[model samples]
Target: MYYSRKRLMDDLPEEVTAIWSCTNEKCNGWMRDNFVLSARPTCVQCNSFMEKGEKLLPVLENANHKQSK
Candidate 1:
């Protein structure tokens, strides 16, 4: 499974910030990256690994704006 660096970067969403957290309930860890350029980052906090197939939630922005004043 060889992928060109440029091609891989292009395939990922620009807004896909931070890698998904380890699903292990006992392990509370996450990988932070630009998403587009990030290959695979291990969770050092828990040593619980996360892979590409793992589910992930988008890091929402403008959360404060959504709140009603």
Candidate 2:
């Protein structure tokens, strides 16, 4: 017997969210602003300085994440 699988399409809409992007041109690292624990977060992948930017991404919430004082 042969079985067929169906592909599902994501219906969530994308929203503009604040993010931190790596300053290094060679590195393509970024993180959501709401998830950042530090006031000034560095790139976790390349250890480079990060700058504020915006991106169109799916809605996400970090209810458990706490900010460092």
Candidate 3:
């Protein structure tokens, strides 16, 4: 019998939004704009300055955000 498990990440919504991408060619890091609180965000991977752009990435909820009662 063959067992194939489904990945939870694959089921996430593919919502397009603005994000920051690493300027460094060696680094492949990015952050969602809604998740970041900065006019100029930096790269989390190589500590380099990030560039603004849009991508069709999965929609993720910010865990740091406070939920309303």
Clashes within 3 Å, all models in order:
0, 0, 0
Better of 2 and 3 by TM-score: 2
CA lDDT, every prediction? 0.53, 0.87, 0.81
Give a tens-digit lDDT track for model 2, residues 1-69.
664443212665679999999999999999999988888999999999999999999888888676552
Question: For candidate 1, what's the RMSD?
Answer: 12.4
What lDDT tens digits, residue by residue, belong to model 3 across residues 1-69? 664455666677897888889999999999887777777888877889998899998777788755331
Ranking by lDDT: 2, 3, 1
Report the CA-based lDDT of candidate 1 relative to the real structure: 0.53
Rate residue 58 of model 3 by lDDT.
78
TM-score list, all predictions: 0.34, 0.80, 0.67
Model 2 worst lDDT window (10 residues): 3-12
Which numbered prediction scores highest in lDDT against the true structure? Answer: 2
In angstroms, give how far residue 54 of model 3 lies from its true place: 1.3
Top of the candidates by TM-score:
2
In candidate 2 the C-alpha lDDT for residue 28 amounts to 98
Scored against the true structure, residue 14 in model 1 reaches a CA lDDT of: 45
| Candidate 3: residue 19 Cα off by (Å) | 0.7
- Taking every candidate in turn, the Cα RMSD to the unseen true structure, in Å, is 12.4, 3.7, 4.4
